[model samples]
Target: MENVSVLEERKDFILYKQNGCSGNGMRCDANSVSGAVSQRACVYCGARVVLNPITDAFHIVHGPIGCASYTWDIRGSLSSGEDLYRNSFSTDLRESDIIFGGEKRLTAAIEEIATKHQPKLIFVYATCIVGVIGDDVDAVCKTMSKKYQIRVIPVKSPGFSGNKSVGYKMACNAIMELIKSEKPAKRKGVNILGDFNLAGEMWIIKDYLKRIGISVISGFTGDSNYENLLESPAATLNVVQCAGSSTYLANRMEEEMGIPFIKVSFFGIEDTTSSLIRIAEALQDEEARQKAIAFTKEETSKITPLVERYKKNLTGKKAAIYVGGGFKAISLIRQFDFLGVETVVVGTQTGKKEDYDIIESLVSKDTVILDDANPAELEKFMKEKQADILVGGVKERPLAYKLGIAFCDHNHERKHPLSGFDGMINFVKEINGSINNPVWKYMEESL
Candidate 1:
């Protein structure tokens, strides 16, 4: 509220100073303002991104072809074995089908996918059109599940009903429903939640935990299959990496299956070490704790010297962060700090009050914090703060380049890992390369 010059209607959503605020630091967890050109994706998109990482599941969009095409292979979530999730299936509902109800089209699509692919699981996503047409998506799924003796789940996500956060909830609910009927033998390992395994990041975390004598029973969706998910309730604990999308599922599992969960982030050196220690402590395994301590000590010694070199080169540079979740934004701030980079602007599409509070505490007094920011707001604040670089997803890439600022891919589109110790090295390398590129000299001269 420190008199930041954003649009009048968006004043409540942007904050320059937290101490002077009477209530919460920034307004968040609300629908994007009308005509704000908010960067948040639709409800169906949110659900699809969260659930589309299941490697073996057949995902069918029960709407027009556009909806399916818009999010085809949306996440960079990689699979080790099956890659059937890479294919985007649609009912291809036409105007005639919309008038007569697209339930038949949806059923036919499911039947074709099941028969040809022989998939064990199928997810039918209800888009805005399906929601409007009153298609009985759930009933169709139930009938198909009975007929094929496979799990045909219905994900209720209408783009017009709510924002992306609501779609995340819908995805979690579908996951819960998927695992409800199973009763697998309990495993002594843990379930890793919220990570979509972009660039095999989940695999890196799994390796770290394995080195510390911890077993990962399954990932929430990333690189996970139907069989693995059926065993989720059997895990001893749920370790959440992306809290925005997976916290609700973890809460439900804890409430019903007595499986406790701990939120952990593995984005930077500090957070990776801390998360390893926390996970070891949560499991109450003495051997694992000692191994984790030794491994972190050795890894830090090897990585710190390399990181210090980058810190020297990146000193005094400032970065603006706009990401899908608060957890990632907070991690990026810490990561930039590791490289001696100042974070001048930060925001998220689905961050809660607690996430924003942590972010506010971490940033400098002059840092601009906003929620569900539009491109105009982002550009204004980035220029005002004089950010040298911007770390965001695909949507923000053009904006950063248009401003002649360096841009780093930190979201689903990236093919590189940025989650563990190795990922930290890759992240700094990319940041250094982009920021120090000689092309900026020409850009500056032209400007």
Candidate 2:
């Protein structure tokens, strides 16, 4: 048999050539090449992805309308409190506002919003334009905080200054500020970090915890509000999911509040079960562990048939993956196996070395892995590798479709919950649906 490798010609990517194409460093990081449409989003996007799930707080985008328009309610964070945060409140800075200064308009917007909504908190997100215009968002927020007698925090999330990781830091700073305002409450409950209740995934996991007799203090951003967040220190433990977005916050919380956190994943069957068990064990309670066992058994049994059926149809298919975090890339390698699919090419925007190691261990010897991959690299790899489908976010979706390949929505914008036992079934259904589409036949013919 021939060595069927998919090495391409003339691309700036280094991941595939060095360090064995595992979703980690050696391929890319914060360094951006001139004029490249890198698959990674801006810093504001990163911060927005992390914080937009707070649900109740008034989140105002302090920039031109585009930033607000692009990120309006983009995450799957479910709202259990006031839905005011979901509203897109952009300063809509026009050319004139940019020149004279946006401080006055921003002040009016804040006062108007405060008078109308009387929200518990208001978060002003600075965008690329705001950073450029030098708007004094902090000063304005401070003044408004006094006038409204509410917490008004300013998030510095400029798009071009750095990549999304910087935004994560900005969001964490805002969250930390929110934590500082209230007294810490000690309780049996724990904080679930990075589990935005997208499609109610947080709600689903919360239910499982409740079934195991565990109380939840709050989620990091998903379905979270100001009051619950301040009480995060009261929780006994923190379960960190989506570590790329929440680990910094968790570490900060641990350092400041004497709370410990554990890394967890709730995507695939294996990850979800393991996460439940890990959380139970972290609490160090016998009753919780036993209840977790029973809960896991029941959910596993219920999901087996669905996984099996999807496995039958999706087995032996080839997939190209592009995602945001290393944890997801790692979990997805396992998820693909459950459906009998092989990941030929996999990559992420911000996967660490440890994550790459896990991805390398999961895949076949010749699989392609990449970090901070651009559209050009992805297109080159997918086409050359003969992958049938691609799994990625909105930016990559259109590119994948343009090349006549199938895609899955694994990003924050997805409407459905892809967590828990039911999520396992939905995962199967989504994968199977894409793999079995009749459009592939047409694509093959055109190719």
Candidate 3:
């Protein structure tokens, strides 16, 4: 028999070792191994992903075109207002600017964007080059704000400084400053934090909350605009998802605005039911509690059958999961369990220690669990683990396809929402299509 083993692999220890993580013992928060094509994006990416859901805000990139180009409308946050947030704007920094300075170009670009869009606010983001060139974005934003009488917020998200979580904190800081500009009001509502409204996921959650008689003041950035964010301080409570990203915003809102925050997830049926109940219970409104129960019952019936059908097809297939946050990985493990699939390999880019604690417990022994994995590592581990399908974001998708393995996209770029009742069904369909495709037969024949 010809060696039927492209799957046979050497154990790349740094790439494969799940335990004895070097960073855990050492000062590991250093720039990731250079030239590894690390899946973790730049600091600007971290900041932008957290803030770009503000549909009316002009999210101007005050740096090279690459930064904006890579992230342009990559998320699926549905907007209820102006769609200005969808377009990516850049100073389009050139070689001359890199050697000289990009400040003037940035100022002109902002002025031009303002003239064209007349946006209520403009968030000017700084990149690695801008950080090095030392463009006074704050000074420029202040001058522009005064001249146009608009809010020009400067985001200090230099790519090299740290990771995506740091950028998320930066986004939260910008929102805090904006909320401070408006007068506070008594809140009859809560803000949904960390939901980017991808394919109307935020809307589904908002509808559920509304039916339960709880006023969702506004989603942090999902379908959110300047006016909605201005009212964020008024919300009595904050329910945060994707804690790796938005937990900072919720914490700051609580400290500065007197609004308490609760961590929640609305992924699988179990998580969605618990989260809905928790939010309703926190309100202490009986009507909300009753409404949540009805929503849960209705959705469970709708989704359970769909899950069962997929489970029947997906029963024995194993999966490899590499996501951005540990919370997502945690939820995915549960979701895979619901589908009767085993997760053979799992990892995250910006997961916390406590998050690792939860994930480690959920996974089986010898299941490779790593942190801040690069392409080489992901490729090696996925093959070594003999995973049938790989679930990850844009960067990881191609690798999976190249290897002739099935893939599921569970990232910001997805057009469909993967939250609540509808999401569960959609998730099933997507996975099923990929796993049981006619193309796989061709791939098998080629193999």
Candidate 4:
């Protein structure tokens, strides 16, 4: 609407700047436009993010070294046990392999890693070139599985195939292969899906659930090892935190294993309280429900006073969001609301129609909602909205700084935990620190 100099094809990718524009809903979940510089990561990135948290798995990038190098230890998923998932393995495919086939080289790489590590599980990710060169990654994985008597999962995540959401589904499919359990759920248990234990956030949630008489069968991947994943089918229900990545896995588990799922978020006080209650209600555990209510009250009481202090300085601040998924954007909107910050522009790399619908309903009428946004689009919307702060991943941080806007790290690589009551306090601290920093005054004076 605002004659932004975006490619004609990308015009539909941006909205809500025109006169009387509501920005309620716009197109989303489509592949990134060619040469648009979209913030969306590759399909392999999606797969890697979802599966890379398995603490004992040997993750192999079946392509060039760049893919593995860039994604190596990309997430701050802390492990309580095995730290094997931290290493990045790759075939380092060259022009020669692209011309012929990298299957042989892939076999050799798997063999090499298997011989040394003797890992029980290995996830082999197919990159863009592997898809182009027609490497049978599944066959290679299958052969290696038999040879080593391990689970060699093939993640068919060609970067060019689709956007990050496609990669999430790809990762979920691969994880589904490893979930094989015939025994019924023995304990009052649930599988935590999509919370990748970033900064031990998963551990925090697990502790709260334990106090409420629930046992965590396993996290979808965060701190979850091969054995934990194999036992995931035994859980009675699945609690999905990051819906964009783990929804498919939850649905599949429900259908195949008869394990029902409930979407939950632990990002803020409101979501955390409600999510705990939802889990208890789903399990029909009155004692757990009571404990969850008591815990919510106790936790909120301790943090509310501190959070209000930060809110006093942060109130009326406008923010922009460009994150990986829709659920996080939705949670941030509510979290910001709790802090009295208005989200003027929000977008996701791979949010679905339903996600956008919920996001539109949550924001103000004139707020912009975009899908698969490029840096230019983010800059234009953030500037147009006069936003004071931007919450995004590493890639978007520099852009926010160059624009003289405050930034917060809400992505995979963030070391600080941003979940539960403690996370709400952290969130407030981050906002207050960024928005009230003294450097901005100098920046404004110089500008």
Q: Among these predicted structures, which one has the highest TM-score? A: 1
Question: Tell me, what's the RMSD of every candidate?
Answer: 1.4, 3.1, 4.0, 1.9
Candidate 4 stretches greater than 4 Å from native: 17-24, 181-186
* Cα lDDT of model 1 by residue, 143-242, tens digit: 9999999999999999999999999999999999989767888978999999999999999999999999999998988999988998888899999999
Please report how far candidate 2 places residue 397 from its true position, in Å.
Answer: 1.9
Better of 1 and 4 by lDDT: 1
lDDT per residue for candidate 3 within 7-116, as digits (tens), equals 21222223323553433421122355655566888789999988898888888898889899988988877886778888898999999998889989989998998787
Q: After superposition, how far is residue 339 of candidate 2 from its true place, in Å?
A: 2.4
Query: In candidate 2, what are the lDDT values of residues 296-328, reduced to their tens digit?
Result: 998899889878877888888999989999888
* Residue 12 C-alpha lDDT in model 3: 26
lDDT of each: 0.92, 0.83, 0.83, 0.89
Indicate the TM-score of model 2.
0.93
* Native-to-model Cα distance after best TM-score fit, residue 318 in candidate 2, in Å: 1.1
Best by lDDT: 1
Candidate 4 clashes between residue pairs 3 or more apart in a chain or in different chains: none
Candidate 4 lDDT, 292-411, residue by residue in tens = 999999999998889988889988999999888888999999999988999999999878888887887788867887888888888988888899999999999999999999999999
Off by over 4 Å in 1: 1-5, 18-23
